[model samples]
Target: MSSSLLPFILFALVASISPGPTNLLILAHGAHNGLRASLAPIFAACAAAAAIVWVVGLGLGEVLLRHPLAQQVMSWVGVLWLSRLAWQLFRAAGEPLHATARQRFGVGSAASLQLVNPKVWLMAVAVIGVFATPGLPVWHLALVFLIIALPCMGAWALLGIGSARWLRSPRHLQRFNQLLALLLLVSAWSALLA
Candidate 1:
């Protein structure tokens, strides 16, 4: 391992492991579904985030920086979308657990969430600005992020799996869902409010 790569690796680990909207949603999904079901979303999310890093490094970050209005619009849209998800999670708290996997959070939704995920874009910008050496390819950083993110996000899924055991009862599950919803609501709104 080159010494130059260590800091970037640390940054990627922290960014991926931290509880953002995506991580929260993944944890919730894993709890609702299982590890097997969580795998697709995990891969999708990691890939999407890596893609964002690559694109942002390539020039999207410059475009976004030049347009404050665009950034504002994106932020508002992302917050609104997150708020909607939070509401849905809150509503699910009251509903009885149906055996049908009708409303499961899948790969497509996970990837789409990355498009609107402010955290992802911000992290991409930071990664480019700070870690992207002049000689290093953007794809190198993207690949590094993807590699570091997998197990970090997977840890969240494992936590969800463990929590699933504790959340067996309806009352417990309801409380857990409600708590996650509240957290998601706060997280979604805090960036704009700050």
Candidate 2:
């Protein structure tokens, strides 16, 4: 409840809500499936991200960041994963919601991917290194993460659900899927360049 914690919580919320690979994927899932289906991945992602934040907060992230090769490897992995996702999205045009939901990555798999996802890693590092106070209790940090990340991510998922309403026809859905795929590809490229 300290004033110092507020900034960190807000920062975490902002970062979580911002468009990124994870959010994009969740949005795609929600649009294709439903808001309920999106929840699994969102929870998984948040849990995974929280674990990374906790580890990094304990000082492991700094060590990982120091290795240039590691960062490059992560970048490449992220690009590959996202590219694959993009391909799937492109192919999902005109597909049934059930098929799309089945094809969507599982929560655990998506969560595990965060380890190699540059955006998630960067967010984890920032949250742990910048927002979290060194002397503060661990529970406080956990609370901050839960308070901020859950709702932010949930909102993104909800957006996808809302978008689904607009896509009534197969052609419209196809175009929407293609656009998302393109966006995912661009995001992957951006991550690689970063």
Error of 2 at 27 (Å): 1.0
Best by lDDT: 1
- Give TM-scores for every candidate, taking all chains together and pairing residue i with residue i: 0.95, 0.89
Query: What's model 1's overall lDDT?
Result: 0.88
Clashing pairs in 2: none
Per-residue C-alpha lDDT of model 1 across residues 33-138, encoded as one tens digit per residue: 8889999999999999999999999999999999989988998899999999999898888554454146788999999999888888889989999888866678
Q: Once superposed on the true structure, which residue ranges of model 2 sit more than 4 Å away at CA? A: 137-139
Local distance difference test, each candidate: 0.88, 0.77
Q: How accurate is candidate 2 locally (lDDT)?
A: 0.77
- Inter-residue clash pairs, candidate 1: none
